[model samples]
Target: MGGESRIHNFGAGPAVLPLEVVTEVAESLPNMNDSGFGLMEVSHRSPAFQEVIDSAMGRMRRLLSVPDDYEVLFLQGGASTQFYMTALNLLSNGGAADFLVTGIWAKKALAEANRIGDGAAAWDDSSNGFKSVPGDGDYSVRDDAEYLHYTSNNTLFGTQFNHLPDSNGKPRVVDASSDICGAHLDVSKHDLIYAGAQKNLGPSGVTVVILSPWAASRGKEGLPTMLDYQTHISKGSMFNTPNTYGIFVLDKVLSWVERNGGLDGAIRRNQKKSGLIYDMLDGSDFWRPHAEVGSRSMMNVTWRLADEGLEDVFLSEAMDSGMGGLKGHRSVGGIRASLYNGCPVESVEALASFMAEFESRHG
Candidate 1:
């Protein structure tokens, strides 16, 4: 605790939580609402917990400006479960789904859909080492496909679709786990949007699913009750003992987001944080960023040291200096600084200053 102020957390997911939220939760754990019991002791079916669950869903819809046509369900599994649920519900509708493989998550989603029914096209961009967005030109989609699936942000590769792909005539489905709440989305553009709450919303237990009524109607009939969107929507995301703690924290975070400026506010602050780091990468010869111009993610900034040999030394020193979780995914094998909503701008500025010092000493 002595050196806590000296450290900053930059982990991808299950990352930094707001100190205010943590403090409030810490205080409440002793005796919530003077009820002589903590939140952990409350019954999931009780009205107290139902209010918590309802408020979380309400905040989600308002903060994201989800349209009335959409149903927002906070499910138990992470976005990974959505990979299969999407296929089980949609792809099983007796038609294939078009998949645009932009990053690791998209590929995984497509693979799951393929297992259940049929994936119209692979759309492999692997030969490029996943550096750039897959070009939308000339690629054809099936007219009868259930839906077109894509991942909006590639967390591992540090690439983001700054512009959501124009779906042409197909229904758009997105895995937005990493970049969901970071900006204002034209929700009308996509029929379905799913994201795990761990990154920007709150914690790791809940996955947010927003589906247009028409898309929800397309879900296959007779699937397992839990995997069905209609089932979760009807239960108000309270079907089977929802993740109470996660939903409680998420509701608080949404309130925080609204007070701070909603999606536009998030976009402005994120740009500032990401810009600080991107500027340093561009100016410093010692640092090379993996994301191409116009395609960079404002959430996760992935970069490499000039020499791979220097990576370990840089990481070790960064850790010693009290900077946390700067290491990128092992698949990508570089440094990734994740600047989620909870991450203070001060953290990125401090990291940039350290990078500058490192470059000066090495040069």
Candidate 2:
């Protein structure tokens, strides 16, 4: 999966990782850091394993410019789990939480909030088919709400919040699962941020939670040990056997990101990658982007062919040309090229070239 035969991966989650990280993981699988045991066999309590987790956390803090007051936890259960965790921990006693329903994930989060306690959709774009973010006047913050929850990027709809919604002096909880680390984000702006490792950080089985001091202080005491953020925070994300190998790979990936100039570097590369396909789409009458111009995502760029009949042909030909995972989500029947941080510029170029040739053949 590391050479020419490797199709340019554009899958949404559990997506591409830097080849260097993959190689390093492969090399270390048999014996990590000169230890006799494989990485998977190493005890999480051992010093060797501790070093891996520490380095991963340290690199993440540096890369995101996370403040000293923030607690970074490498918890299990992806962002989906976070939907309930956030509500359980933060939603005030009998107080409703406010949610901006921009896409499917946000809707799920809102539903979880309703089940956990009281919740309401402060703003929703479902009527518009989730094609765009709510305009400035379309939404308002609830002063009495416990916290505001929003999905920073809509992977399914291919829409992103270029500018975060105004939380209006309230604590903002962001589910940045897909677009985390893809740009220089002001981590201090939000009270809490959660992302699944499979998208841009590393592999599945781990979730990264960045909690500001304020957010950490609000956790409910009676919650189960595993569900409590404070539990992970106190133990330094070592409450149980952690995702040892996933953290190892994540450390390697973060090192790669740091070597490449951290978040700023990622922003430049992603912009270029997404821009290539977008420019092609904008210029061509054959391909049509689903997201609105101002709301398009830099990570997952989705589009469709003019003739639905040719969709199968395009996917088949793209696969023959060493391209993979261009099919969109089932909810949206078209194409989605997820250009996560690990995807190289070369792969985007190859994809762009393929799109051109495809359009030429089908036009």
Residue-pair clashes per candidate = 0, 0
1-363 in candidate 1: lDDT tens per residue? 233574699999987777777676667676655656687777778777777787888888887778987989888889999998988876654468888787888888987887788785536667777777766673667777768888888889888887767556878999989888886577778888999989888889889889987778876668889888888878877778888888888888887888888888888999999999999999968888998887788989999888988988888888987798999899888799999988888888989998888888774
Predicted model with the maximum TM-score: 2
Every candidate's CA RMSD: 1.8, 1.1
Name model 1 segments beyond 4 Å from true: 1-6, 33-35
Q: In angstroms, how far off is 53's CA in candidate 1?
A: 1.5
Q: The CA-based lDDT of model 2 is what?
A: 0.89
Q: Write the per-residue lDDT of candidate 2 for residues 205-252, one digit (tens) a residue.
A: 889999999889988768898988899999999989889989999899
Local distance difference test, candidate 1: 0.83
Q: What TM-score quantifies how close candidate 2 is to the native fold? A: 0.98
Per-candidate local distance difference test: 0.83, 0.89
**TM-score of each model, in listed order:** 0.95, 0.98
Point to the candidate with the largest lDDT.
Answer: 2
